[model samples]
Target: MELKWTDTLDIAIELDEAHPDVDPQYIRFTDLHRWVTELEGFNDDPERSNEKILEAIQMTWIEEKD
Candidate 1:
C-alpha cells in the first residue's frame, strides 16, 4: 500500500520494522523525515510534510517501538 502523511501509525510500524535498532524517541525530525520518504512503500509528496506531521509520526513510532 502507498503511504501518506496522514498514515502515521502505518508509517511508524514500517519504520519500526525497518530500523529495529534505532530508538524513535531519540531520532531527529530531519532524519525521521528522510527515513519516512525513503520507506519502500512511501509515495507521498515529501514537501507535504510539516512539523506537526513529523511529530505525530515520531510519537507513533515511539509507541510502536514499545
Candidate 2:
C-alpha cells in the first residue's frame, strides 16, 4: 500500500522492519523524515510532513521496537 503522512503506525512498522538495530527514541526528525520518504511504497508528498507528524511516526516506531 502507498504510504502517506497519516500512516504513522504503518510507517513505524516498516521502519522497525527496515532498521531493526535502530532506536527510534533517539532518531532525529530529519533522519526520520528521510527514512520515511525512502521507504518502499511510500508515495506521499515529502513536503507535506511537519514536526507533529514526524513525532507521531517516531512514537509509533518506538512502540513497535518494544
Candidate 3:
C-alpha cells in the first residue's frame, strides 16, 4: 500500500526531532530532502524528519519509554 501522511497526529512520526541546550536549529532542507528520498524514495517528501522536526520544535508529548 502507498503511504500517505495525514494530520492524525500533531507531531509527524517520520521526522527526527532534536533537543539541545543551544537554540534549536532545524535540519537543512537539502539534508532532510535527501534523507527522505533515501528512505521513502521521494525528493519532495514532507513527512520526512517532520516528527523529529516537531520534536525539535516542541518536545513535550513524547515520553521516555524503554
Residues 1-66 of candidate 1: C-alpha lDDT, one tens digit per residue: 899999999999999999999999899999999999999989999999999999999999988877
Candidate 2 residue pairs in clash (backbone atoms < 3 Å) = none
Consecutive 10-residue window with the lowest summed lDDT within model 3: 57-66
- Model 2 has an lDDT value of 0.94
Which RMSD values do the candidates have, in order?
0.6, 0.5, 7.6
- Give the runs in model 2 whose Cα sits over 4 Å from its true position: none
lDDT of 2 by residue, 1-66 (tens): 999999999999999999999999999999999999999999999999999999999988888887
**Compared to the true structure, candidate 1 yields what TM-score?**
0.96
Task: Point out where model 3 deviates above 4 Å.
Answer: 4-11, 17-25, 40-66
TM-scores of the models, in the order given: 0.96, 0.97, 0.30
> Compared with the true structure, what per-residue lDDT tens digits does model 3 show for residues 1-66?
133222212222333322222222444546534433444423334644465444442232233110
Whole-model lDDT, model 1: 0.95
For all candidates in order, the CA lDDT equals 0.95, 0.94, 0.35
Report lDDT (Cα) of residue 52, candidate 3.
Answer: 49
Name the regions of candidate 1 deviating beyond 4 angstroms: none
lDDT score for residue 1 of model 1:
88
